[model samples]
Target: MTSEDPHRLEAGHLPTPFSADEIRAATPQGRTQVVRTEPLGGAASTRRVRYVEPDAEGVIQVRTSIGEDGEDQDAPVRERVTWRDLQSHASYPADRTSLERARLEHPLGDLDCVRYTMGDGDAVDTVWFDLARPGLPVLLESRRGSDLVLRVTLLSDEVDPG
Candidate 1:
């Protein structure tokens, strides 16, 4: 869906929603090669997945989130951070094995997502990874107060090979 799509949000609204195929198509535009995609189950009021892109070295992890029409009541709150940061701060694992272990230890029921509530349940955030498409960056959306925040995390392996 081009940037002109009506479903595309402006300002604080959020980007337009794209299907798995659409996301895959856009991967090439990012200049990186897309390898594969895998869906991560366990989500409440939304769908989530992890996009895996492998380059010369390792695979890049991309997380994604899609809101449920009726389920999302509040506005969106967006934020971005590295896997290392998520691991250090939010108890998210930097690696897939650790993440899977955490999932088994603290399952989110049938949903493959985790909900983090802040400030007396008035603010809530849910996180999931989309491994469905390579080259596609990780997608994150947060809802707080009357605004919805959306974030896309791209892997800069080529530019920042560390």
Candidate 2:
């Protein structure tokens, strides 16, 4: 957010103002996302499907792995105020000074994203949230030095916006 920030341009942009309606419009009920994950050291990437739905209280997300060595594994069901809340890192730095804006290209399409980078010891994790989709994460990556440790990309959304 500052001029000296390494991730931002010399001329910084204003922070995005978000509303509940914008978040709701971006996320629909019964939507599913296809996610791909690549781990460190060239390990085989894995595919996962995440189902999203809205309940009277909030949004629910259930994730299950695709083909792998063994049977499919289901991740614990998550409930959140919004679908994007499920992917949020509560412990991450919350200061606007740590935020950056970037154009991210994913299987879904080219998108404008709000980026946040955090470092812990030797590892650095970067998360990109789609600007058009409120809190939806388009990509997440972790690296040590220059070697990628993990990467997760939202490949597609099954729900049609219409």
Candidate 3:
């Protein structure tokens, strides 16, 4: 599996909310590269993390701003995660999200996907992803009432299923 496969999530992509346990269950054997970006406004900063699990190796590319000019610095950092680590973090579902829409056009303008809305009132989160292609997150928006806290958008994705 390579990141430059030009697969574009294929077709008929849909996403369902994976409970906390489900995410934990999928940690091991499901390794891929994810690229996401957060637009800057708060703290005048943006971050990007690309998780690389090559041959059971846990590597990540961390990018952050530095200095008063907000220049960016990127570095590759590896923090391996084993099956036991994931199992230790697994837990029962605390909250559930319902499917909000289907066949929705992703903001990236390439893939068709689904949306799930979770949380309540002041702490609502909306996530969209392609179940057919589970590499990078599609889009994640978290808001507390009328104020938006964080927004992460997919930049690119390549799945390396080693």
> What CA root-mean-square deviation does each model show from the true structure?
16.8, 7.1, 9.9
What value does the lDDT take at residue 49 in candidate 1? 27
Model 1 Cα displacement at 125 (Å)?
1.4
Q: Provide the lDDT at 150 for model 2.
A: 90
lDDT against the true structure, per candidate, is: 0.32, 0.60, 0.47
Candidate 2 worst ten-residue window by lDDT: 6-15
* Better candidate number, 2 or 3, judged by TM-score: 2
Best by TM-score: 2
lDDT of 1 at 93: 21
What 10-residue stretch in candidate 3 is worst by lDDT? 1-10
TM-score (C-alpha, index-matched) for candidate 3: 0.52
**Cα TM-score per model:** 0.24, 0.65, 0.52
12-108 per-residue lDDT for model 1 (tens digits): 3332223323433433312332122222332233323232443322334433334444233444333333322222233322222122211211221
lDDT of 3 at 65: 33
Put the candidates in TM-score order, highest first: 2, 3, 1
Residue-level lDDT for 64 in candidate 1: 37
